[model samples]
Target: MESAAAQVGCLRRTSLSVSDVEGRHREMIVGDRSTWSFRVHYHSGDEIVHMLAGRAMLRIGQSARRVEAGETVVVPAGVVHRFEALDQLGWGFVSEFVAPGAEGPGPAKTESSLIAGVRAMLEDRYSLRTDVAQIADACAMSKGYLSRRFRQESGISLHDFHMLIALHNAKSMLKGGSSIVEAALDAGFYDQAHLTREFVRTYGFTPGVFRAAWQSAPRLPSLTHH
Candidate 1:
């Protein structure tokens, strides 16, 4: 897949990129105590999170659980959950959405209605596996039409868009201190190797080096509410 920087339709963010994963709809969140933390939200699929460093609390269902570094937490789909850092030291983790039995079609051709619908579908059920044919079916269009319109309108193929989303989320997770493997899974990539390839392709830097630089840099401004 082409890197986000190489794609004309790719959306750009700060070095610590964060965005919705297109196909599998997974999202990687990087939260710090000094800056900001994650907000309460629920996904259509299961959410798996692994803490990389520091301390925090996860509100799942009706109970609150303490989550420390090196710990992993899983929340079933549709369960309301929120995360907060425990101290000024802040915390970092990687999260991914997974739906074992959910069903959905892929996205559509490149017009406003088709693209909007495709975007909504991706956002709603990104954790589930899908294909271009399925998405075109959902859009009531042919795969060829979907491909042409999408490429013409977005300046990138549908598949590339999905990869872009995954890379963006992975970068955010890496910045948040997640290991290469953790970020890979969280961002819907195949594995660490896959993430490395995408990372280097998207940002022209390896994940390991990016993490090192981020760890040594000044802390990000806290976004947590008072």
Candidate 2:
């Protein structure tokens, strides 16, 4: 068999780098904590996250845990997960694998028509103060029922979903040269302090720092490897 050895994406980060290993989607990953995002995402296959250095607060589905250096977490296919590094630089590697002949991981199990409609509505009006009671009424359901079902399907509370959207908008405005205060108000935060608090909790960093990083770094280090 021909050797499959090949160097993939560049490591524009700290002196460390991820070596490509066959089978795993990525052999390793080493980057600043800012590289991690708060957005909950999933894979089409089993993902193995191995921490080589530092630590992070990891959320898998409704469960949250701390993953430290030398520890590992296995995320089953189609499960929602996200990570927030405990410190400025956390070194880790993530591997993805899908069994042969199995169906590809596509959508979350909870993506019903109702959930899709709800997602659309939130995406459209995320800046407004959400009234779940009204949303429930519109859907002809009780507040508690809608809340529980939405959580079950999205792996996030409805309020959090709104907040995430708001933060996303704020981050974009910041990238586009909006002042911190402007970004906060535009994204529906009560004030800069309000946006700052939520930004820290969600991104493990403050809004000012995020904007600075974006301003200072114009481009990702071209994905290179040894």
Candidate 2 segments exceeding 4 Å error = 1-50, 54-57, 62-112, 126-128, 219-226
What TM-score do all the candidates reach, one by one?
0.46, 0.57
lDDT of 2 by residue, 30-104 (tens): 343334545565444456777767778888767789888788788664456788767766545443333312242
Question: What range of 10 consecutive residues in model 1 has the weakest lDDT sum?
Answer: 8-17
Look at candidate 1 and tell me the lDDT of residue 107: 27
lDDT of 1 by residue, 1-226 (tens): 3344433221222123223333222334443323225434444456677787888888653567889889998876544456777868877666654322334222222236755676666644434254789899998899999989876655456776566556656656765688878878877877777876666544434676556555554432331100
Q: Candidate 2 at residue 92, lDDT?
A: 50
Q: Which candidate is the best by TM-score?
A: 2
**Positional deviation of residue 2's Cα in model 2 after best superposition, in angstroms:** 56
Runs of candidate 1 exceeding 4 Å displacement = 1-113, 123-130, 223-226
Clashes per candidate (backbone, < 3 Å): 15, 3
